[model samples]
Target: MKQLLVPALLALLAGCATTPPTPLAPTGPKIDTTYTAKGQSSRARFLVLHYTVSDNPSSIKILTEQQVSAHYLVTNGPQPVIYRLVDENRAAYHAGVSSWKNYTQLNSSSIGIEIVNPGWTSTPEGGRLFYPFPQEQMDVLLPLLKDIVQRHGIAPENVLGHSDIAPLRKQDPGPLFPWQRLAQEGLVLWPDANRVANVRPIFEATLPDLFWFQRKLATHGFAIQQTGMLDQQTRTVLSAFQMKYRPSDFAGNPDAETAALLEVLTTPANAPLPVVPTPVTTAPVPPLPPATPPVPVVPETAPAPAAPLPVPTPVPPAPMPAPVAVPTPATPPVPAPAVVPATPAAVNTP
Candidate 1:
């Protein structure tokens, strides 16, 4: 009995030893080298904004290296300079576990730009701990964003933040991010205030049936399913939407304002077209004539007939009489030609 007990214990120990270990969670930065070879050409679109919730560039740079690195980093200072940390072509280790419309894993298709600022929340005690973005930083960001958006052929709506794509987890470029200015520059999408006001009542009445709102958000490239009920996922998606469209107040509730804003955003007429500024000519240039130049008029002239050439007379040949057939002796019948058997041609050997 003692020996059997020992063997049983040993068997239990062996079983425990052979059990599989738990898999490690995905940690640290996601360094994707798939696009490194091609650079910007490898990237398909531009995801144009972010905020490094760090006080300074050095801290942000260190954090980015230790955690994740964006394609570009703009410093927060009086005279901000844009730093190209990673090539635009490579997939920067930003945008973790994200989806937008048909696209999933946006890092594969986007170039992320991080703005250095200490993005923080105010305490109930009313302490001003949150560091605001410097004007100079935004000034630098706008032109850079424009260049990237134009070069990559990224649509105005596609220029979204890390929070917009991964709303459940992130909110880097928060409400303070200059979305209005970017919209004015035609870099991002902005809801028309008047259009949103008009659509407010419709969204409010249909708030109970969230499916309608979810469908519209999905149509506008947000990754949301029309589940009818306002679930946790729906709330998260709505929070993301609020962060982008209604940043001033982002409580994640399906309020009239949020719905109205969404309605305006989804409408084509409300969407701003890409402004093409006419090139300003410094030197005074002469204006060109009309597209269809005027035809020169010609005076009418009377037509005159010239003298006709003399017609030649027809020549007549002398008429000849038909000869009569001479009668001749009957010739003997010709004999049939003898038939000969043709010889077969000899075959030639190669």
Candidate 2:
């Protein structure tokens, strides 16, 4: 019995040793990290700048908790801190219903940076006083902008303000925002001062019409209607441009300086200045000839000659019909009385 037990235990041990442990099932998918495709580009195309019209705590809370969000938020202070709320690869809920040039709905293609600042305050005289951004905040923002621009190869023209994209609705990063600083950093396009000076006089002599203003604004990447009138929408878009380029007077009115800036920005270095339409004046009509006595008209004694009679058209004679022969039946049919049934009924009554 002992030998049997020992042999049984040894057999079980041998069977267990001979059988390989069942391979553990894989818990996750395996991917090879050997190669990467070069034909790829970053999802972010434009860098839109904005201002958070609230304090740092409120801004952070609203951005994180509310539906609206941005990729980065630069807090306001002497030493401002930058917080990246959303990943660069993901779309932020900024730039709602926005457009730049031909692109629309910029939230899908842009990375938004919201700087903490009180947007604006209304003055007693019905004017707005926009808040200025701190230099430290700008300093932090510039490096971030440079990094993103370098990584994504964003164009200088693509660096836009929230107001630039949504001129009809938004006015963030308002007139006080330092656009010249961005220009200096080579993040945005700036019109040449010399060119602006040279072209300003031409516009000063005669300002371009509203149509010209709309065209130049559209050409400069603002989404404006080509209305030939100075409509509110046109004025708003014009004001957006002025807020960026000429902050002193953003009243949306077309001035010589605005015209020069627009022309210089939109026109190529070699392109000729657009011809301004000359105002047309009507010539004064000569005084009507002094009224002269009406000359009595003489009526002809003979009546007008009778109209000539219309000539009658002669009718053509009808052509003779060709004779057609009809075949006769072989046997003649007998004719029946037409009223035979009525006569039979009268005879029955009789």
Candidate 3:
């Protein structure tokens, strides 16, 4: 019994000796990392879409080796792959001299996605032909877009094309890009067709002046100057809008339909439709009635006194202009300055 007890005591001591000592409490300054402020939001407020205008290999090399970069890239063809070229936490040199709404220098606050596309080619007839994004590429892109948009809490209006943010200098992700598809996915805002129809007739009677178009475009988030004329910059911006929403005829003419579309988009109460609007089926503006032929003035007889020779048929008074609708409560239409000509209806497109 003594021998067995001695062996057991020795085994117990050995086990205790093998056990590690408890660690000493850390003595550095304590940082309470658990408490986080709820007032903060993501640095990325906008998602700008672009077209690389080059093949995949060229695109990859240029994006990586050059000063310009994008957060993500979607390649073209049947089996497209998505590449993350730039870290989302850092700014990419995609947007240069860009502005949207009140925000300028958008690269600092936007995530850019460069899609592999040729942008547009000029036809022999002096017309531009834009390339269409493939279905396979779109399928891959849709998921990535959804993921980023969800993670960043991006708004529908904030998903914009390259041309949209920099209308004056860029037209990438051109008319062929299926923005209507994005709208159907609830990733982008589309003007409500019904609202456009409701407002169209009013503009059809007499389209709003160029100054009005500038104000409405600014309200809809384009950084447009109110030049009060149909300038090249305004046309380019207007064309960008047309490419997204109305690709049928984007001649950049300030037509009644364009006016209606602008009004609908800028309306605070506008609820964009999730479905794609039928292409090339915008409600046609009714043709204006021909002006009443002016009555031919009979040559006055020399010194006709008492009997005014047979009174010529009296001309009817001109019809009063239709009342313009003020959809924007924030910006009531300013009375045109006297410097602005009384007759600006005859717009000269540049």
Candidate 4:
């Protein structure tokens, strides 16, 4: 009995000495939101572009948090992967106090795309600068933007940067972003130098009323009002405009070139839709007056005025013999004021 007890106790002690296995942590991709239903409007009119200032994990945290989120997040790694953080149908809390053209509160009407980038960094010249986006990153973005634009019937001009919409505070998808390539893809508007130059002569010859320029910018999806003065708001709008159309030289001044470029962009293009004529409800035509009966009536001729009425009442002609000569007055010569040699005020004795 003692031997059996010793063997059982030894077995229990050995089991206790062995360490327990550790459970595996949860693995695989994390999804913050899901699309339960298809979007009501398949046509996405606006594309609000942004740059992810944080790394992947940090970005995920920011987007997953209730306070902020985006529809898609494009990572900047070598392989460049895109994560759909929020369902496209739902409004992502990305755009804030924004306006574009007629669109206000763009969060309700636009798709937010966050591109992973460090944004502005310091250059050797001691100026804040941006890094070039990797080609691989753009490789993923181009197709995605194409898909979204195509599916939603988004206008080329509607695809815009975050700064474009919220210029006063945000500057994302900065100058280094490949907008020219995007324009090449038919995703946005590009100004032609020739067209801009053609209008340059006009702009330079005549000083453009600043208010008119402001109105033009506001008309083109920029958030600005015609204040008749070039204020900070106007500068912000110009800065946003420069970021998109005049990226090479964005000085935020409404110079001749910028004004001319704006005019070109706002001009109407060649597509015209057929106008349907309104259905004419012709009032029943009244029966035409039954062929007018022609009555032949002889006209009564009046007697000619009694031959040559007497040529009486001839008034006598007045005499014009008095020619009075008026005398011309001589002009007085004004004398120059006497030059006064004013004495200097007496100096006070110190």
Candidate 5:
């Protein structure tokens, strides 16, 4: 009994030694808390939007079980529901490998919204089809977005799409997503349409080159390398911007119009700010693609260059035989004129 008792006491003491420490319990002045009004603010300062390529059930399974999650998952179906997965206070793994403006690893300082939709379909023919978010889903989204942004005091500039943050790896909430609609709701910033129109003609006349576009894009908070080359990364950044502003066309090709839009967005340059539309009614915007997927198109190929013009064959010049020069008698070499040696002049002794 003595042996057992000693061993137990020794084990207990060792366990206690290895255990982690907890906050000390207050004894005297239980709290030294200050009741001051001034204090720190929330960690979140940005909001990132994304679309799950899978349906609601699949998205939930992937987000939860796959160790990747979002603060909220919005659904569009028989009954639209906004499901809160991770608490807003905690970080979610939704914005992976992302950066926008002054933030990086955005999961640290951003609230991520994942809406359920078939993001994009790549047909066998190598063409991509991006689907638009349903009206029902967006109706639920507006209030939620407004609340999040307002509560965090997030800037309009900080609201970004996942692709806007990770252009090379993501293209979510694709072109069909009505960013302009969000802008009207005061959730995101939009370029003044009138400003774009004013600058477009100027740009077309003396188009700003690649460097100008890159600089403006970087200033607009895109994390792009200023390589001044038409590289893939540059194209991806252009595509992301087009998706946000000019959903009508996002072929990823840089043009005078694109440059003009960037210029307008970055610097209005004496242009008046557009008033936010109170009752958002978009015109000329196509209603989301019909339920039936459009016919798959074969990837575009370069047309064969116009057949080369025929070159006229040149005739070879007639070969001339070496002329046999008649041996002209060698004329006597002309005698060189003799140079007379002049006498050196005597130095004058003054």
Candidate 6:
């Protein structure tokens, strides 16, 4: 019995001795210590423009308290004020259920600016009249937009309205909003009147079907459904396009004029046009396109309004201007912020 107990204890001791010990964690040089950036990029790739339908106070509440938010808000009071709500480095919950070209979920890489406006005013005739942005609002907004575009290196084409991204759902910064003003400032592209003049005659003879328009709209970055029929979706896309390009009349009805405008935009800038041997008449730049350009329901109905020349799609940022380090406003930026003048001055980007 003694020998058996001794042998059992010895066997347990041998088993314990044969077990391997737990290994210690290795410690030596730190990884990725000498880091060097391969290339450069901007935190924000797109700048989406919107108009808060709610008035100043309501706009503030909807933007801050509600689920929706914007990086900046421009007020429409006597004194137009630009308020910074969301930081540029972070995402804002402004664009939803949106797509542009191949990009979707724009909130991930876009900076949104909400302009405060009554948006739609009640008409005695039981209709809604979309209001235009004030001169003062555009004044501050221009500089602020310029600053953002320059700092972030946003392309002229990438500067889009809420409608441009979500044509079916949004119409803010509506038909009355002055897009040509941005075009004149080189922040966006405006269709060339001359090109439209040359193309209108051709489209009048052979109007392309709805399918062509849908394809062009998609190519130009409006997330429209291609049903090959003139559906509500197509009209919304037309309205959105006309709101920006032909604000004079946005009936959502596609006409020869709309078709021509679409063609001009899709036409290659380098594409050649017919040239006749005559005195090149300098086209009369129509009185700075009206606040609302008259939309003709049908192009053949009257001396057709020439198609607006094609405006190029958003381009890359390098040639326009590189972005700079913007001062991050902690809250709604109410204080008189330094304006980035629309000039040749270069911005210091980090």
Best by lDDT: 2
Q: Candidate 3 versus the native: TM-score?
A: 0.69
Error of 2 at 174 (Å): 0.5
Give all TM-scores, in the order shown.
Answer: 0.60, 0.70, 0.69, 0.63, 0.67, 0.67
- Per-candidate RMSD, Å: 24.8, 23.6, 33.4, 26.2, 28.9, 47.2
- Candidate 6 positional error at 86, Å: 0.9
lDDT of 5 by residue, 249-281 (tens): 887888988987887778745655333235666
Show where candidate 4 strays beyond 4 Å: 1-43, 122-127, 270-350
| Model 1 ranges with Cα > 4 A deviation | 1-42, 125-130, 204-208, 270-350
Residues 1-350, candidate 1: write the lDDT tens digits.
99999999999999999999989988999888766454445355757477877657575657466768888888877888777877876778788898887889888889888888878867889833445677878888888888887788888888888777877788778777777888888878788776766667665555636887789779877777778887987898887788677776676788888867776777798365323345687987789876997788887787787799899999999899999999999999999999999999999999
* Clashing residue pair totals per candidate (backbone < 3 A): 2, 0, 0, 2, 0, 13
How well is each residue in 1-350 modelled by candidate 2, as lDDT tens digits? 99789999999999999999999988889988999999999888899999999999999999999999999999999899999999998999999998888899988899999999999999999988889888888889899999999999999888989989999999989999999998999999888898888778789998899999999899988888887999999989989999999999999998899999999989877787765556798999999999999999999699889999999999999999999999997997878867745443345553
- Residue 151, candidate 3: C-alpha displacement in angstroms: 0.9
- Predicted structure with the largest TM-score when compared to the true one: 2
What candidate 5 gets wrong by more than 4 Å, as runs, is 1-39, 268-350
Residue 281 deviation, candidate 3, in Å? 30
Residue-level lDDT for 309 in candidate 1: 86
**Candidate 6 lDDT, 209-323, residue by residue in tens:** 8888999898888888789998988988898999899988898887878877887787777886533235678988877755887787775555768999999899677765679
Error of 1 at 247 (Å): 2.2
Q: List the pairs of residues colliding in candidate 5.
A: none
The lDDT, on a scale of 0 to 1, for candidate 6 is 0.86
Question: TM-score: which is higher, 4 or 5?
Answer: 5
| Candidate 3 least-lDDT 10 residues | 270-279
